[model samples]
Target: MEKIAPVRLSVLGHPQRLAVFRLLMRRFPDRIPATELAQALNVKPNTLSNYVSALMQVGLLTQERIGTSLRYGIDMQSARETFDYLLLDCCRGRPELCAPTSNFDLNNKASKKYNVLFLCTGNSARSIFAEAILRQEAGDRFNAYSAGTTPRAGLNPFALEVLQQKGHDISVLRAKNVSEFQAESAPQFDFVFTVCNQAANEDCPAWAGQPVSAHWGMPDPVKAEGTDAQKSLAFQQTYGALRNRIRVFASLPLGSLDRISLQSTLDDIGQLENGVSA
Candidate 1:
């Protein structure tokens, strides 16, 4: 049996500390100083000093002395802890609320990894982006595929370009429609994500396999009409968002994750918008 997530996760006990946490998570782990945190909070330096003192006292804040100032950030491990706590409440009286690891044994034989499918309206932009990132980040753990509800016969040239620019190889990529994978002998999907806002909103075919399905809504980057740089930037944002979500899904303990717990977490993944929303 899994232990319940800790209840001390809320920083709301001190609004200032909560403010400090938001400031730190936004700036540092990547180091903003005390003044930066105060400026972000729009509080006076002296007032912030007191708040910082209290926050640092708790494990939520970490501080480092620079030559002339102190930098603080929301301790990420603590933030992850708070997320776990939020999940626990969802599990009350129903352990399925907070998905736990499965107990299946596959010690000798090679176990099958999960299958993920990403869907889009056109397959030219967003689907391509999601497919590449998921493959790069989670391919070893999950087999990732992308298809368009209405196919676009070829890959998005810019999608290919931006992916390569970001260090992903796309020499063998191509575009296809959702129908291609819907045939009688289709591979069973363990999960599916729709990236296009329109397709995500539409009633998708009832995936007969009934794997976990969710939407990670994102605006169409291919809609951007302007210079190459502007279009490239749009693709970059799309790529980053997909990459972040794929990292989270891949991080889940699928090998031991229980179905109830997995389904609940997958549902929570629906609350995610773009990448960081969850």
Candidate 2:
């Protein structure tokens, strides 16, 4: 069996490499293109190449060629082995202190799946990304939707490209005005998040459920200019910011926390640093 070694530790020791690893883990079992990875990390292609090579050499990451793209993914079996190896002799046979994996219930049931809505000014990029991220990450526990104060004619192509590269299904997503949800027949939402500054400050229709709302302001990637590379990078950063915040939000214990605590936690998640770790 492969064991955790100094080499693997060294490979992950670099902050950027570690960040890359975490990003891949967020999309576990799915692979993303190398170009997309570089864009997401805001690193030069050459620099990302070096990091990927080092990680792959230590059996931490795997790559495959798909058409003209090189897709990268975490080596889950190797990762699990490494984690087990690290905890093998932890706490000197005291299982309690070691916190053995089996000690915790992995099947705790949530009371119900929550309905969530992501809002923005355009519903073309930031809100779109948030909707996709939350749906993909917590579909079993949340019904995710997105809308705009002033809907765009269509989805942003760059947003679709970035989401496609990350293996998210973009076929059914569309830009719609928030008035659609304001109708009495609309599904009652449990949570509502505004993912851009303009939407957060706008006058919103009163939701049926009076959903707890919070603002998670992220830069508008659709407005990014310069070279194609720069635009792609901007989209990637926006996607990353939404993915991280959504991940944190999805992990909250909704069945246990009261409304005040849940609202506080939601606000805290919104306060997380945009496009970077909080």
Candidate 3:
């Protein structure tokens, strides 16, 4: 085991190999296809294959055939073993000496507040719902903001109705372009989420501070078919979905998770069923 630890460490010593490992860690439990991994890392397929092969050889990664293409994910047990060996054995059992320099103790009631932005294509419905819900849920701990790629002139009436029905204040809600938040004077966001498929795929402007991002895509309530009653029902369901996800998000123990683990948790939160809370 002692001999193997160095081999594992050496494999991750290279810059590109380390990047591959970290990316897989952040996307844990969701195996990424080779093509997607290559494009994300901006590395040639041939070159990435070699790096992937090395990590797999060291038991740090697992691969499976998803149809014709190969998908890769981190082997959590193996990664844990590698980390344990480094801290418990190689560091002479003094784990305290190996602690990360930066502190991650973000208390929910602490003065340290995080800026979060929720995005959709129109800024009229889903993103607005998220901003209001998160504000209602954890306003003191998080500063929630919402914006859109190509924003509408005003807020969706049904969206506003549903929010107001739920006792959320709607007077301050207004549609804003994503560019407004991208300005230099804009608050540095700690997290950003895309609540619609279109906004998730759009080429968004580079944000200041490079916030952690995830896609929480849900149906556009504004596009719901049928009568006004049915349309309002759609908005109501969207509200429940966003609230469900936000509740779990607000409950997260941010102090306990490193950046990679936090990102993985955020991704998993996105996969939560519409009416379910995790």
TM-score of each: 0.57, 0.59, 0.64
**Residue-wise C-alpha lDDT for candidate 1, range 1-278, written one tens digit per residue:** 02323323333467776666654543323356667556656789999888767666556667788898887756667666666556655555455656544433322224467777889888887878877887788777777788888878787788888888878778756788788778888876777777754565344566754666666667788888899999988888888877877788789877577666776676566456667773
What's the lDDT for candidate 2? 0.79
Model 2 spans with C-alpha error above 4 angstroms: 1-111, 275-277
TM-score result, candidate 2: 0.59
Best by TM-score: 3
Query: Which lDDT value does model 1 have at 170?
Result: 82
Error of 3 at 131 (Å): 0.3
lDDT at 23 for candidate 3?
A: 75
187-233 per-residue lDDT for model 2 (tens digits): 77778888875565443445654566676778899889999999999
Model 3 regions lying over 4 Å from their true place: 1-111, 275-278
What is the lDDT of every predicted structure here?
Answer: 0.69, 0.79, 0.86
In terms of lDDT, the poorest run of 10 residues in model 1 is 1-10
| CA shift of 161, model 3, Å | 0.7
TM-score: the better of candidates 1 and 2: 2
Error of 2 at 220 (Å): 0.5
**After superposition on all CA atoms, what RMSD does each candidate show versus the true structure?**
12.0, 14.7, 6.1
- By TM-score: ranked, best first: 3, 2, 1
Candidate 1 residue spans exceeding 4 A from truth: 1-111
